[model samples]
Target chain A: MSSALHTVSATDTLAGRVLHDTGVAVAECYQCGKCSAGCPLADEMDITPSQILRMLQLEMPELDDEVLRSHTIWLCLTCEMCYARCPKEIDLPKVMDSLRAESLRRKVAHPKARDIIAFHKSFLDSIRTCGRLYEILLIVAYKVRTRHLLQDLLMAPKLFVRGKLNPIPELIRGRSHMARIFQRAQRKDG
Target chain B: MTMKMGFYPGCSLKGSSREFNESLCAVMDKLGVELEEVPDWNCCGATAAHNLNHALSLSLPARILALAEGAGMQEIAVPCSACYSRLVMTRHELQENEALKAEIADIIEMDLALNAVPINVIQALDRALEGASLESLVVAPLAYKVACYYGCLMVRPPKVLRFDQPEDPMTMDRMMERVGAEPIDWAFKVECCGAGFSVSRTDLVAKLCKPIVTDAVKRGAEALIVACPMCQSNLDMRRCAIKGMSEAEAHIPVLYITQAIGLALGIDRKDLGLQRHLVKVALPRRAVVGA
Candidate 1:
């Protein structure tokens, strides 16, 4: 029970890691709730944007874990609404990005985030192979990963009829260069 | 003599929102601007890269900027607002941190002079017009009520983008007015349209787009004018998903800013890709004399 009362230093917390990764000090947020007030998806999020910051501010291991596992990080559209309206100018989206990365690394991303993660992975994989986004390939891969094959099936033919969905992707000549960039970026991330 | 400008039509332009590219090209061609495509550009990584790996996001856009710089282009026009935001954010990040810029340069294997700046569609068109009013070039003015939806990426993080008023941006509205269209003041102008989740989280996208579409219609806007591909697609492509919207409300067409301008310039409907939209785009036509 005494362990629950033990104070965790700011530098030894998830907020510290966020600060180190993004240079956005979560401690600067004074819980004005302005971020939550402006967040477009606040109603849908399991944890509001400002609450995520408050969790970080708390600097407890349990709270830190909660922040990492919360669906708010995945739900963020990176629209910068919170950052724009935040009186502290905390750049909450940047912090969310860091939290998302950490969440994936720790394998504790909310289970509901599966589809979103699948879409992102598929999107990146398309770029990795073709240098540009191959929408057809991305959709196929996403459907395969999410097992939502029937989903959006009706819209595909419509897009194709509109000349929006091309059968063959336009490949850039600098394929090898793009591969090299991806490899180096992965290495840097590791 | 037509002015040559560097053009980076990001992935969405080539795929999901080809109409945006078509209309943009048609309008620019009429405006005496020749779009020079950047040689062998790759994806800017968009939301995925930044969400997963920060270095990759910076490296991808840095590579495009480097290619534009190598081509001796002073600035490149990015029509997609998402790509524009990524490129501009990369520039701002690199400018702020020399070490990160060097790291990104090493990753992309380029000198990264960062000379080639990115201009969004509005900025590009504004520059192409060269201080002349759009009314001067209009052959068929788009005389209809419109809600200019700036969406999220184009105007947010105001300190970095520095292009318009973050909350109540009127640049697009002013442009629409110049083209003889009535731009209405409405909420949800700079709101998010649940971008990047169109494929994965359709429910969320529908819920987010509902307010934007409803507000525009409630304000009696004939069409929702947008500069971003994601915004247009979310509002137009996902209109059917927005539950409880009346049949008439669901039919409100979302038009790309370039499409509206192309119509005012008297560019052919097919050339502007007007037939490509899910919702039929039939603006109330009023007679106007070409200047």
Candidate 2:
């Protein structure tokens, strides 16, 4: 059970905005810790998935970005174990994703999991350029950004010898169409 | 039923997991189906797009589905579990929310077709060979004990996937049984192997994948079978790299379901891309009956 901190009010739009965008009602969660119990990476999170929802239930602030900056949001595997075990059928993964989107959009500080953000940015950049992910190029770019050049050095030669790494990325004919979609999505979001 | 399916190999299949693509093609050929490649398919946006922008994630997969429908494909088979999850989730979201669908339609510059249902390789093969003769195709019975690792993306978010039992999925188990391999009951079948974090958080991935690899081996599983390239990469390629596990202790061979099937069909190991694996693959010896 969560300690009493604040009371829920009608004007709290964080819960409403979440419900509007993702259809997940934060008020429905009873802080059973069922989600935390089932979460595989719960041990690594600064705040458990259940606790994150509890914050919204209390309506801490509309744009506090405190929960968004928590390592819990980035550490989530999006494996949906918590989502599967939720009695309220609350999609924790979706909620976490929404928080991550908000975190990125607001340019809030992601204290932990900076490597994940770098990898994600590199991955999307790869797709945006080639219209498809080029693993070899994506890895190099990620390595450069994260300064993890030495982690998987041993596996590179093996991957290449096995015909896994290609020198050039295959460009899809739908590249321009995909670029258009990216542009529209950005404009709409902005 | 001479079923033809449009195949969306995703980027992984084309890049790192070429063996998955090769084995799938060989197995499907034996199962009697033509896997027409979806032409001009873009990335499925995977975990990256969804976290940054909601519409880009849905629109990316929607574009691929729309292309499959345009190619006259009623069913699309995706071998990568991440891609499968993205595609199915996109459809689920679009179907449930009409406003989102309309917005996505405008962004992609096309109508979002709720049709062209996506199926993973396991389901696709099971459906194709449902009434066909499977015993005759088995030249090599995969007699060794194996663990079918579904990981999270394949079966989780069960409401949207609607493909198998979330906690205890038996599609791979049943399929492996049909092919003469004993599928072991393991705890991490639907567990997460730290997907997408493989590159970003190697230590975290190693930590997560350690138990999965150790438990399967501890249970006497000769090989840990997987459907997702990420799982295979994490478990197989990064087996020795895991923080806690030693080289000898964590040396179980991780295989794609298609490669395992190709072996049972007695397809040459070379054709199945067995040699591509990092942990040297060694199949158990067959017991001769008339010795």
Candidate 3:
């Protein structure tokens, strides 16, 4: 049985990349299910937090693809509940962050993650345009991208009446500085 | 002589949750604590940055801290817990990893000493209230029962934040007590309120926040007190969706810790931006004393 068993190297698997990117060792996860048990969104996830780690631990390419394409990565709110409760001190949120990035890079993100990704992109675009977040701009961009124009139409006028919705973007004098920061970060990551 | 401290309001304070910023400033002013807004501050990149590019996440917050440091500000009060988490985590990460620190410095085109420490609303209030009893400052004590909601970012990943007990934090509860508000020991005090998904996944947020609101109301909490702007928006703005998820109606008003303190200090409701809430701040008028 010992001779028939094959050992997979840590440096050559999805877990290795996760470890390299997030410094979270998936191999250290012992499938205790403690993370899944504590996760607030475990039931909603396509795969539980511990299962994501388990897939990485298995060192299988197909399992890795499934993990990346799973809605679990995008659905994660990154509340850090799993990490906070994990006995092994595994940083599951960091792992989720890395996995989401990888999923986006590989174009294997789940179809259900479109709205979530659209919102994130719109949020970043608003920041890149204005030095700070412009709520109206973010909402407009998100609505345009998702084409969910009528989703929150009622909330706008109410917010406007309450002075919660600012009509104009609050531009910072260091707008160019903000743009350069985004440019540099994208260049480095790209 | 008024004590001066740097303030980083982030985006929410400028827009959707302006009430939080107004109330926070009001409370601080009453305590003779003058807040100096950080000059030319930018966004902290929030959930979008970290979820997509790790480099950008560190760079955005590093730039904010570097700007604060250059302005000679030693400590900054970050009222938004999401921004607070990002700034504090960036400082911790950069301090531990020299290579990443240098990279972030290069990206932001600023020095990376990380001298400016980020303190959440609770910590800032604690500092402002030091050596003085909160009861002494309360002109009108709040007589209603409240559930002090800490929510995720304020006190989670306990290793990094190191603010209070992660699971059952009592800092906010104690502050509520000082203002004569009865804080009930309820579950979901530190639960996640579907943080950034308030916009993109409103349905999910409603599903997640329902239990929190339900528990608070079921436990006889007259209101839910929060320190994070995201939690306030999720619990307040998404009340309709939460209502749709259940047959029972839960209309408990979500109050920011600063707003609650401001009320206790007899600050004007309009000045505190109390009228901006989606669910009306209709805590029983009978609870107001000496008004």
Best candidate (score: DockQ): 3
Give the C-alpha lDDT of model 3. 0.89
- Chain B fold agreement for model 3, TM-score: 0.96
How much lDDT does each candidate structure score? 0.90, 0.84, 0.89
- Write down the TM-score for model 2: 0.95
By TM-score, the better pick of 2 and 3 is 3
Please give, for residues B1-291, the per-residue lDDT of candidate 1 as tens digits. 899999999999998899999999999998889999889999999999998988898899999999999999998999999999999999999999999999999998889889899999999999899967788888888878899999999998998999899999999999999888899989989999999999889999999999888899899899999999999998988888889988668888999999999998889999999899999997767776543
- Cα RMSD of all models vs. native, in order, equals 3.4, 3.1, 2.9
For model 2, residues B75-118, the per-residue Cα lDDT tens digits are 89999999999999998889898988999999998866788889
Task: Label model 2 with its docking quality class.
Answer: medium
Model 3, span B233-286: residue lDDT tens: 999988988654433345688999999999999999998999999988987655
Off by over 4 Å in 2: A1-12, A62-64, B1-3, B246-248, B288-291
State which candidate has the highest lDDT. 1
lDDT of 2: 0.84
Q: Score the docking of each candidate (DockQ).
A: 0.79, 0.76, 0.81
| List of clashing residue pairs for candidate 2 | none
